[model samples]
Target: MSYWRWLWLALKMIYQLLCCSVSLILFCFNVFWLFCNLAIPWCTLTLLIVCIASKFVKLQRSPNEKRLLSLLSTPEDRPSYWAIANRAAGFDAPENSKAAIKKCLARGYRNVLLDAGLTSCGEIVLANPKRMNVAQQSLDELQKLNITEYHPMGSQYEPESMASLRQFAEFLDAEADQATVFLRLHDTSARMLDQLQKFMTTDEAFTQRTVVISRSPLAIYQLRKLKPEIICGLWHETFLSLAILKSSTLVTSIYGAILRNIIAPVIGISVVFLSKEEINLHIADLWRNVGVRPIVYMVNSPNEKRYFQKTMKIQYLTDSLRSEPHLLMKA
Candidate 1:
């Protein structure tokens, strides 16, 4: 049978089991209450809790099953798959900021994207948190790597300041002709738009090669007007819920469709989902439907590393720690 068919059968079986079991329990309780033949004591509550816990145990995913799933639910590898790639490919900052980026460069990673945000601690120290450069040591490491493009990380879209906009424009101007700089806007503000417009019209870098991570349909419409080099879809955050999973024919379908149908083709854009587990069948199917690539994120474990490598079918694998000079030398 087709994959969809199997998915449908599985969903139906789960629904039936849930309904039948609940109905049987309710019927037994009602029958006993109606007869009033026995005294109900604390034992009854204890029994109910035990039965419910036992049911939950049966419903839990087994260890081997989880491992198998980790293997089978592989993500695709493609330029469009950067959402997952970024998390996997992130640098371990505390010990060495440049290590991960340098490793990516050595591994021939040309298209580089990063999550640029200030942590609570960073906010207290830096005046412009997002604009801070990599550590000198890290920058030195990056100097050794080949980088063609960089995308600024973001989620909200806020009005921009002319000064910040100019700073960004200048940063773009300083880069090579082939190099592109993309911004991820999280807040939707006219001031931000004004800044974007200034950068797009006046700045040679913005006019020639710049991209933005846009979420609002309205912002996308405005961005397309700029005639940017590329407009890709960006999923800033994803939180999974039971409602989303069961609502679909396949567990992955609901989310996949939102990104594909609702986010991509409409804007002539590509998309990135933040979490691997969150990129369910819904999102993958959506990618298949729209012919758009899907990406997953934030994978740090060794087991996850093996699973993504062997099963995720991801195009690019991003990981923390570019390289420990020691580890690389040892290798």
Candidate 2:
């Protein structure tokens, strides 16, 4: 199954590259025709210089990157994991619920990844904004609703309420001493940052152990600017999804690579969550050379887990702990 999946992905990538090459040829021809017709030699020469200059322009390290480098010098600060429980082991309980987190901890997983979004009252909750209108409802109103109703295994577990980011932090402080939490932010608004800043200020441990990740480069940049010491991560996959929708996969892949390699470093991200399809030794090494940890997501196969863990020596996010019970024993 894995081999077939890889083959399919390779074929898709080849087709995309062919399409992109054709588009680039047409675009270049059109631009050349315009340049010849208008006869603007100076404008063309100036544009060429700017493009060439951009290649050699060195990017200065941000304050956050410097701080991250220092922190990474310590062996204890380096992230090592068997797997991160995606959505707090959602298969065991409702995703982003307190029950899911408790179950994940009980299963001996040390790394947990949760989605975060803001409520109507400016409170951060562990929920996906895209799935529901989390921003339109107050925290109180959201908590009253049964989060498990829409879940496939809702009847198997007791009714669960939406878990707040504060509650997750407090739970970590009390129950899980060695655990690390990764918060994937769905709402990257100023209000959400303010709340996160407040939490990080009050809890020193949380600030050190928690990694805040976002798909938006601007959001990550703003976060680093606001709190240079806080651990931040950039999430990739949105651009690839958009590329598929727009039928411009190769062009988008090039843009995504630039964003991941160039823009993410400039934003001072400490970690990067890449889609499973994007996992490759070259890209992983690229991130490692620059002091950024690369993690793959939605990995569920046990064989793939062993490859990523033993061979790649990288962490991954998995949806179900039940699928890999033996790995939990090693963790």
Candidate 3:
């Protein structure tokens, strides 16, 4: 099943890459939008915040990576699958809306994720604020991630309401007694991140309940400098690749030629949905050697959830927990 899905993802990515340029061009174009978005507001930030010095940040100091692989070595590593509600429980409501996220939490998913998009003005809104007269795929120049809901062909597009970062923070404070929220940073501006950081520091609950996932090296690095205790994961999306080759640490790992200690440290990763094919001990050992756990996405099927719960024994970042309501308590 994973093979077929990954194959389809490969084809879709190929189509997108050919239709749009994705390499460094993707990052460069986002920087262009960053400036445009920043310029939307009169001022960048309302408050002045001091950032910690880079030199003072704690670097990954474990002498060997084996010690950190402790999570992967034991059956007790995770008793219940630690699932992350991908995009706030998938089309249950518009992605990242309060309604959908609440549904996931009510269904017993303890972790939820949302894409954090910073607006041109100083506000941090959810990733997909609906735009007027916009063709969905073309919204991003490079079409990376392409997280959007498909409407009927020729259907008029209009956004009613989307959650703001502040609104999400408030919701998390209220709803997180039963769960945690993971914000995947989409915009890396210091001012934008400051909005998130300030909200996080409001009380002990904020920092304790919130986790961050980011692709930007500088941003995550800076996050470490600021809050060493926060759990941060490195997120990677390839509309393709096998587990051994496409991870964020691939270049540093050199196909396992180099020691994992030399690779950049990340607590976890977002990857394709794992199936029975991924249960090989040899393959698990290779990943264990690296010390990073896979946060599998696309666990929307009840059978798959049951399989993962019984066999995979790891974290799953899914969009269909509420859709498969019966699987929630049993799995």
* TM-score to native of every candidate shown: 0.46, 0.72, 0.57
Q: Write the per-residue lDDT of candidate 2 for residues 186-257, one digit (tens) a residue.
A: 888888888888888788878877788888878877776767767888887645555464587666655655
* Cα lDDT of model 1 by residue, 1-331, tens digit: 6999999999999999999999999999989996564545555566557545544432111213333223223234312222122421433321112333343434433343433222222110111224344222232343343222121221122222212334434543554232333345554455455455655665544544444555564565455544433344455455445666657665555455454454455455544444676654554665756644455555555555456546765433345523322234447
Q: Of 1 and 2, which scores higher on TM-score?
A: 2
TM-score for predicted model 2 compared with the true structure: 0.72
RMSD of each: 20.3, 13.3, 19.3
* Top candidate when judged by TM-score against the true structure: 2
Sort all candidates by TM-score, best to worst. Answer: 2, 3, 1
The C-alpha stretches of model 2 lying farther than 4 A from their native spots are 1-80, 155-158, 241-257, 325-331
Q: Candidate 1: where are CA atoms >4 Å away?
A: 1-108, 114-182, 204-209, 215-217, 226-229, 242-259, 280-282, 302-306, 315-330
Query: What would the per-residue lDDT of candidate 3 be over residues 24-118, giving only the tens digit for each residue?
Result: 68889899898778854523242111112222433553323343233223233223335667777755655766666666656655567877776
Which scores higher on lDDT, 1 or 2? 2
